[model samples]
Target chain A: MSPNVKHRERNRRAARWLLGLSLVAALFFGVRVGLDMVYWNDPKHHEQQLEPWMTIGYVARSWMLDPRKLRDALALEPVPDRKTSLGHLARQQNIDFETYALRVMDVIARQKAATE
Target chain B: MTEVALEWLPVYGLPVLVLIIGLGCLGAPAPASLTLLICGSLIAAGDFSGAQVYVTSLVAAIFFDHAGYAVGRWGGARLAHWRIPLMDRARHMLKTRGGMAVFLTRWLLAPLGPGVNYMAGVVAMPLRRFTPFDIAGEVVWVTLYLGLGYVFGSYVSQISEVLGDITGFLAFAVLAWLLWRFIRSDLKR
Candidate 1:
């Protein structure tokens, strides 16, 4: 084949390869979107998982508890003007964040149990 | 980096938010949408004010978009002598579908927003035209992500993941379509 014809043939092959790659990527992300929808839609997923970054107010909202009631239950000091995350609360209490989170989670569980 | 930013958000608040949005708009990799989602959750939890987050984020996005555009305009002039095929294609796309491209990239295809801004400036899309479409699109972008977070406060992370996947799917779908068209045209030739 002439050089020009050979160049055209090569371009065609490259274009087919790119098209195949794009289709595969589209399918991968499409499946992920489907799986995420299914997982989040399950009733068990309705409950928010606690994270160290969450503030007391955020956790209270997630758990459907009154922030003040939750704070009083935790026996935390008066609310500071600035919003404080669970990590910050742990630091002030001189405890590890995980331990502090567990203590807070226990209070939440008890409160939920009482309400039920 | 995202973890650190999320942790600092409740403590540092708006400054952190502004920095993230600004960097993201300037084509730096940042989780601006996720931050906006968390801001919505924070507002719902009463740690932040809805109006404040909305206005601050919107302003920051627009300002940084303009900054990206200015950089593109400056650099594009210097690079004008170079005959880059990709630049030519981008210029043609802007000429044909500038408004819709600007609008869609702002929200529905947010990952493309910064690049579109630069291309729009590189092609010298009128500031008058660019401003209205940009502002309108940003309004939708800010409101949609933040509203979802507000309405589904506890599910912000899950929602972010789903949104990311959806965006990726759509991007690849479009790429596939364009590639198919190119192949067909080449075959015909």
Candidate 2:
């Protein structure tokens, strides 16, 4: 065989490494879909549970869990009843509109959690 | 995009095309790591099949990365004459940070990987100097994301949870470290 043919053969051999990577990709996509189906159907695994925004809100709420405890952090008075309507609580506090909005959402989440 | 479009062959094929096109145009402006993470999860769930797809992707990424490094390696003969618009910042980044910047962008965040190559090409960065860094970066990138896919098995939501845990740990560490530093600095001052 000519040098070019030999060179081409060498390249082919080296490229075989990609075959393994291809298998992995196949497995990845295959398994991923299966897991999603299971997760979507199962109520306990949180597969299809909350919307994206709700998850973010949940995490944000955890960050400010102790709003009233920390002297350095923003210290807002806790709503007297976790079940109180957010609109009513916001109106009573006279807080900034943005602040009230977020508080109202959190308050609603708290109320919703209580009922659940 | 539709789920069908995201099949194994296309994922692998597109990047290879990019590599064949000589990588300068293909290398830059790569997608974010989150996308790969998303893929990782999908793979685990058994949503996609085709080993050829990932292998193609890996090879394409490495190939393009290398091509970019090569273009950069060759002194500015091509770049100075090339008529690319609004790529000064990237070109500047390539110059100042050198191979470290290239490596990091390729390995860490990833979006910048191809862009770094283009910039290096624009300025005529030498191929010899660009090779090692590009190689290392590709290895790192492949290992991290591909490994994540292998281990986690691909379910976007599950991977999201893992991501959440990582984010939480980093957040807590940052907060604690800052608090400690603030106290110590205040006492000294």
TM-score of each: 0.86, 0.39
Tens-place lDDT digits, model 2, residues A8-94: 455444334433443444455455556656765786774322212122212233233333332112233444332222233344577
- lDDT string for model 1 (A1-116, tens) is 99777766776787789789989988999999989878867999877677666888999989988788898987776677349888777877899877988899899999889888
Highest TM-score model number = 1
Candidates in order have lDDT scores of 0.83, 0.46
Pairs with backbone N, CA or C atoms under 3 Å apart (clashes), candidate 1: none
Worst 10 residues of 1 chain B by lDDT: B80-89
Each candidate's root-mean-square deviation in Å?
3.2, 21.4
What is the lDDT for B22 in model 2? 35
